[model samples]
Target: MKKVLPFVLLLVAVVLALVFPSVEPVTVADATFDTGDTAWMLVSTALVLLMTPGLAYFYGGMVRKKNVISTMLQSLVCMGLITVLWVIFGFSLAFGEDIGGLIGNPATFFMMKGMLGNQAWPLAPTIPLVLFAMFQLKFAVITPALITGAFAERIRFNSYLIFLCLFMIVIYVPLAHATWHPEGILFQKGVLDFAGGTVVHMSAGWAALASALFLKKRTTPAHTPARVSYVILGTGLLWFGWFGFNAGSAVGAGALAATALATTTTASAAAAMAWIFFDIFRGKKPSAMGACIGAVVGLVAITPAAGFVTVPHSLVIGVVAAVISNLVVLWRTRTNIDDTLDVFPCHGVGGMVGMLLTGVFAHQNVNAGNTTGNGLFYGETKLFLTHLVALVVVSVFAFVGSYILLVITNAISPLRVSAEDEEAGLDLSQHDEEL
Candidate 1:
């Protein structure tokens, strides 16, 4: 059944891709598309897609060998399921015309009806509407995948499948619309989220925390990571792909992309260093796991401020996120919250650090589109205050909404595996496979 399910999903995806070609029936007049920008977006889409596999390795390495395949599959399945959903209506609900400023109007681009060829997306005016949709698809694909690290090795596969769909429809899409759409309530309020600090990381982070709490602690308290090397490799891939994740948000081959690329690079490097140093301070050896986690936290922290802040500013963002996440991980061990891999500390807390710091250091000079006003450093209070409000709103929405979805998913089918299956591990019990 597992093998057949994947194959059927793939077949549906192939058909969707073939049916939705690079041609549109209706074209907008005077909508100019640039070849250079199109070429850049093509690469960016592929790069963003690579992050999912990178995430699989990241989460896979952190679990026991008995559950590695299941851990990785949790990340991989989203690529298929979310792609099908996005093409059908996820894109429309996220980026289609506004509906009361909360979500995209479903009728605007249902089934991707109007997105292709010469049609230009208002967000990325220089790129094809289809390309923009595909690019955004990558973002939607990875957000839910990030939450799997929280409840790894214990979740029922079928219940998770259902939860993934609900999370996207009820949580992710609305957050994306409210933050990214020009007419979005948050966007109109002058909140500046250059690349999903609020929309992606914050939402996923809080949900991860909620999921961990709802699932309760693992029956066993201690478990070992299967492979540290895999963690290192995953970190490298995530770091590489993040260039596209952050810079690609520019949606053009322009100066903004370049600045974002520089900031992303520096932030990760600085965070990695800060993380290892913190370990040294705690009288622990500088471990590869710590390094990788630090680097990823840095990447998460800089995501929101990548385009709005300068490269040097990213150094502070990275270091701060690493130090704070390190502290949270320490605090977590003292509590009963079994966030298996510290997903909340690394992503949720790191994202908050980045979002708030963006309010502190963001500069209009970095990008000429400075309508959001300057950060605290520039003596402007509006942008900083607005980010605070957004942080609170997104956190509440994600935590509460995710809890409800889990309740619904549990009602349909138990969310946790049976005690016997969990004891045997998800790889063998859920999928009849092992590495």
Candidate 2:
């Protein structure tokens, strides 16, 4: 029954495409479209799509040689699985008409209906609705992929697939709706996630922690990273692609995009430097792995504040985030919790730091769209308090919700590998392929 189930689902999807070839037109006049914005978004969408593969390489390099293929495949498979889920109903669940401010109604865009014509998302008025959907799809793709690092080398691939779907439907979609949908609770609460500190980073980070805990320690701890060079290359790709991930939130080719781009660059640079310097201060040699991880941490930290804070303050965010995340990594290594590649420390902690700092440093003067008022540093307390509330709420929700989902997934299909399989390496045990 399980063997035929996937084929049946795909067949049903094919039937839907054949049955409803033409979706109805969306609202918004054709003249409202801006070529420049559309063009930039097209590029942005492509750039964001590149990130998943970069993540594959980034994660692949950090796992043991025996498990490298399995680790990387976990990231790459999301490109396929999440993309299918997104096109069918994942997008709707995230961006469809609000369902009581918590989730989008799946029927609103079921099978991507109502995607034709000149419609624009309410928040992104310049780009076509389809473009906005595609751009957001990239965000959805990379998110669960980020959590893969936490349970690397120990999970069952089939079980992981089930968990991935549940996580997207249960966790990522709700968070995306609550943060990005205009009617979302967080949006209504004045939660200012310029990109996805809350939606992408915080949710994924917390889930990563939950996964690491649920999976427990590997049978035999994985050894040193297979290839540091792949990490460097992946970092470069991620750095390049992040311009779109952050700036494209502007939804148009405008000054805000430029501002986001500048801040993204500066924050990543500052974080890389801070990581190396912090390592040196701790009597550890500065290494490529540290630099790459630091740069990515900076990117994660600055994601929320990219468009809301100035460049100088972005530097502050980077430096602070790098030091904090680095410390968390140190702490995690000493603990029994075996989060491979330190996803919680680097992304979860970095994201939390970014979220809090956004509340602290965001200025109304930088983006007039910020009706939330100035951050705490500028003598306002509302935004920071709101963030604190959101932080606590989201952290608990993601962690607890994910652990439940993990338990459910494990019940359906055992999550852990057999000890024999674990010793043989997941590359052969999981997929029968090797790096």
- Which number leads on lDDT? 2
The clash count for each model shown is 0, 0
lDDT of 1 at 148: 98
Quality of model 2 by C-alpha lDDT:
0.92
Question: Candidate 2 on 1-435: residue-level lDDT in tens?
Answer: 655766787788889778866567877664388899999999999999898899999999999898889988888889888988898889999999999999998988788787788888888878788899999999999999999989998998888988989999999999999998999999999999998998898889899999999889987774889999999999999999999999998889999999999999999999999999999999999999999999999999999999999999999999999999999999998999989889999999999999999999999888988989899999999999999999999999999999999999999889999999988999999989977
How displaced is residue 358 in candidate 1, in Å? 0.6
Question: What are the lDDT scores of the predictions, listed in order?
Answer: 0.91, 0.92
Give the runs in model 2 whose Cα sits over 4 Å from its true position.
Answer: 29-31
How many backbone collisions does model 1 have? 0
